[model samples]
Target: MSHSLSRLPTLATAAVAAAIAAAEPAAASRAVQSRTVKINGVELFYREAGPSNAPTVLLLHGFPSSSHMFRNLIPQLSERYHVIAPDYPGFGYTVAPADFSYTFASIADLIDAFTQTIGVRQYTLFVQDYGGPVGFRLAVKHPERLQGLVIQNAVANVEGWSPDAVKQLAPFWKERNTETEKPIRALLTADTTRFQYEHGTTRPQNLSPDAWTMDQAGLDRPGNDAIQLDYFFDYQNNVAAYPAWGEFLKQKQPPTLIVWGRNDPFFTLKGVEYFRNLLPNATVHDYDAGHFALETYGDEIAAETLRFLDTLPDK
Candidate 1:
């Protein structure tokens, strides 16, 4: 009887251990890693995740934001694909040298070098806000390197500009001066930062305050305002290249997916249609949220992105 009791205890312990193991979720194969690489004399900070051999999705962030914007989406996508989100010069943790030109073209050049240095020869480009200009520049420069495109509130057509945004940015586009900068400076305030995330959401209360808090913190950095202003003024150059970008899209017709926020005040819904007109085969998902759709619909965006990526020819 004693022998049976002892055996029962051992069996029970083994059963409990097995149950515990079963209850616990399997550990993820990889976790997001923050890294920095020297490119063009500046250290570019990037967040990377997923297997090196997996198809890569390069995320380019928008203005007043960084790779931090993709904090949630990276790990989700990394489960099945290699994801890279880099902070351009003058943004995020990237070192901005005084001599570094902050124009979209210059930043694009730096990002191109960054990808080459990191051995990312081919990737699906994910562009948002300021990322649109930078990523488009890369697309035009090396169309062969592009495997696909994922656009989130990124504009490539003049009609992408909201009427209000057009009026507000008129002065800066026409001329860069103290008087013209007044309205642009107003956009740099904390309140405006908060509004950018909360304005178009159905559940403004559900949005995390951290979104604006982190963005405002980045903007408050010394000389960042000047850097942003320079980029804002240089945006006119991007507008001028819209036709070329359109032509590239029409020619390459790379499998494209656009996840847009209908509530975005900056880029109009027309922007999504413009790409659709160019690449009729492109898949598009629209969200009720504003400029930063990922902030609100990250899970949905990640799921849709994975679905869209699966449709592409495997590299």
Candidate 2:
């Protein structure tokens, strides 16, 4: 599941490309400039593109990934809208205090402060993986502020989970047990890169080695395993709250789009069905790609997202 560099951009190079591409075209461009906003005591790192006045689209990544996940898609969408992607605390360039609790609720709280600091009262949410729990917190709490919800390979329904995920993360579901934590940390190794890439995509040939390495580095970092372990523990709580989350979706029913990778080993295509059932008005697109469908299907996703935004009520 490795793609050559000549065909794809590395994380750092992709960031620069996004920025440069954004600056060249006044009409359609994306930049990779970064800004830090202090939320409580944590400083969140964010990258943005397009005109500030353009409609805002906030992109959220999953565990072990940063805003860099949207490196390709942002530039494409920046043509007609503003794209903002932020690194969740403890991942990417953002820093988290060693003692900080990395629960989803805490992360959600930080996102709330982050949006306010950026002066975006209303925005279209582009959430993936861990972004599901984090973004749902914002959607559930501030339903009025969301113009649309664009979900990419995330679980809103418990049925969407794969058996492998349940197996790998099962030990930590109830609470963090030291025995279960060891293998959880082991998955961060270089070997898991192939597993990660293959799980997320149908076309393993398209997976970029650098992307896998970037994510691996973050997971392999000192103390980072604790954050992931905490997230694993919090995810059980998220699973328990799934019913309430579905009810929230039914109640709020914001304009939504569900773009999923059928091959995603973690959040299975069942996740898309969950969103469809809850968001009866949702537009669902299941691609042959894997969990990181946006990476392989950025063009289609960007186009679909723009169309989804078009269907939203005027902000």
Candidate 3:
């Protein structure tokens, strides 16, 4: 059989001249844009993708991470949903005023202003790590504005915390001193940051070094350690709010979805049960991955998220 020149792979064929798709996974069809806005006296950096008119998915990142953490998942949903992932003050590219307080409540207030500034009236809140507390505060404050909730590797209960954090932070919450802050220092190290990405993931080889390296760079910024320490102490307030957040979930019951990494070092699978208890109807999916589950299973999680989002009643 004679093959046509067009069908053959050769140096002279046009196949090599055609536009080559990006080497990234097909989940990234929608181009993600990095944008910054001046709001609430702080410069907030966020990644935006998809049609502005489409349903919005507000992604709130976890501790020691910024909008960069959502890099993989944004493109997966951007084609059908308006996805916005922002760096909190003192995180990523966000620039906060010197006097700006870094407590979760304050950060939540700023984020509230951020949504109003950017005109996000309604959105599905996707929270991970430190995002759990921040997103909950927003949910409670504006229950009417939430289309739904997506909990990823974050917790509203004490059972979800890793022993290392609770052991150190619990005492710090009780009393902040050099003795209490010592272990806190260890948690903030670059080594610990790298460990977070590598510890429980199923495929370490597939994970990007950029994730933790970028996070460590953010953490290494001058005075960021103080901000992080403040967060460690402020987390006590979050623990106190669990009852109220639980009540909010029971009372509001916005359509809920829970996606988690069963092997996360910080947030245990047990913490997910808190939501399952409050939101019996909430959808749940867990993977063998770690805290940054999307790094390993973004496609699977995105497929699940698309299915769940499809079922929700539009605003």
Pick the winner on lDDT between candidates 1 and 3: 1
In angstroms, the error of model 1 at 256 is 0.6
> What is the clash count for each candidate, in the order shown?
0, 8, 0
Worst window of 10 by summed lDDT in candidate 3: 18-27
Q: How close to the true structure is residue 15 of candidate 1, measured as C-alpha lDDT?
A: 100
lDDT sort, best first: 1, 3, 2
Tens-digit lDDT track for model 2 on 1-315?
A: 365755456777889989888766775345657788777888789888887788889998986678878888888778778889888878888887776778998888888888888888898999998999989889888988898999998897767898877887877675567787877877667777556666646566666777777888887788877787777777887888788888999888888898887888788777777787778888998888877787677778888988887777777
- What C-alpha RMSD separates each model from the true structure? 3.2, 10.4, 5.3
Per residue, candidate 3 scores C-alpha lDDT tens digits across 226-257 of: 98898888889999999999999998889989
lDDT of 1: 0.89
Best candidate according to lDDT: 1
Q: Which 10 consecutive positions of candidate 1 have the poorest summed lDDT?
A: 22-31
Model 3, TM vs. native: 0.90
> How well does candidate 2 score on lDDT at residue 203?
62
What is the Å distance of residue 262 in model 3 from its true position? 0.4
The Cα error of candidate 3 at residue 55, in Å, is 0.5
